[model samples]
Target: MSDQTGSAGVVLKYTVSPDDFTRAGEASSKVKNILKQMGISPDVIRKVSIAMYEGEINMVIHAHGGEITVTITPQEVLMELKDVGPGIEDVEKAMKAGYSTAPEQVRALGFGAGMGLPNMQGCTDEMKVETELGVGTTITMSVHMEDK
Candidate 1:
């Protein structure tokens, strides 16, 4: 998707494809590049990259693809991931390290170590998850920009 800028902020939109491990990190990479080009602080860039990458991978592995919208402003970066796949059953359990519901096949790929949510939380200043058992899930994360 094309990037857009408006009074609200600079918005970047991407579509994560299911089971596409080879292309999974494209969005995060693009965002990182944009942040770098914008001269954002390295710390904030690093945090946003890690959190967005983890969320993108989760969408690919569990959610069967989704949409990622990132809004960058002077104060903070906001990332929203929305998917229509099977929703998370337990948010708490999912947040725990080494606890995962990913299938054996997914684990074989060296992913699904159950660190996705935890790592995302660790990197972002704020995060929120909304899910329904059979419906879908949406995760919103934010990393506040710090004064240099």
Candidate 2:
């Protein structure tokens, strides 16, 4: 399903599966395609895609699964990821580079570099994270559109 604004912008949603390395980047890839079809700038698309991809992977490795909603408008692209996995205990520690809690099997696959949250923050113009110890985590990120 999608929501339309005055300018015909689009909102897309995807469900992430647990430990699904083979399909990890699918959601981000789809978002990139949608942005391209809408004639969004490549730079903006790149930033959103990278951030979304990282979040998706984190959901797979840590959260077991999650849901992501992406909203594209004339002004910015917003991505919201909600997961039912163990919530982050320390947001500050999690944000540090080279710090990861991923299992060995996951790290062997060339992921779990401890860069997911940081990378997401770096790529987005705005970001907010809400997490509960045993409940879940929700991350909202936005990338503003730039004039061509």
Candidate 3:
């Protein structure tokens, strides 16, 4: 880990709206800009942005939107995404690279190629997904900073 700059960490929150395709990635983009302004490493920013954006898209397409909380510190960047939509029936299946539960409508939009979870797991240092069939889901992911 690198920086210990933020005393407790800088926290940012955002809301994802159902079917808000137009604004789906706004929060992630804003975070990327903020990271840049804070002089975060490019690799870290890229990983964080990719994970956050994928989560946002998943919420819009399957989970009927959700809320996202991100904490930035010198040591790492953490993001937690929560949704109240139908939870993943099979976490194992959903984690498959090409597996998608999106309906035809979502697929037709060219956004549901089943890569959200895979990509999220790929770029982050650690990731966790907690879900209930009809209750909701919460995904927590973190990307740790490293010494150059």
Estimate the Cα RMSD of every predicted model relative to the unseen true structure.
1.1, 1.8, 3.8
lDDT of 2 by residue, 1-148 (tens): 3445555467788888887889988988988988998899899999999999999999988898899999887899999999988999999999999888888998899888888899999999999999998999999999999972
Model 1 stretches astray by more than 4 angstroms? none
Q: How many residue pairs in model 2 have overlapping backbones?
A: 0
Candidate 3: the clashing residue pairs are: 3-74
Using alpha carbons, what is the TM-score of model 1? Answer: 0.97
TM of each candidate vs. truth: 0.97, 0.93, 0.93
Worst ten in a row by lDDT for model 1: 139-148
Model 2 Cα shift for residue 142 (angstroms): 0.2
Minimal lDDT window, size 10, model 3: 1-10
* Model 3: per-residue Cα lDDT at residue 33: 92
Better of 1 and 3 by TM-score: 1
Candidate numbers, best lDDT first, in rank order: 1, 3, 2
Candidate 3 ranges beyond 4 A from true positions: 1-6
CA lDDT, every prediction? 0.94, 0.89, 0.90
Best candidate (score: lDDT):
1
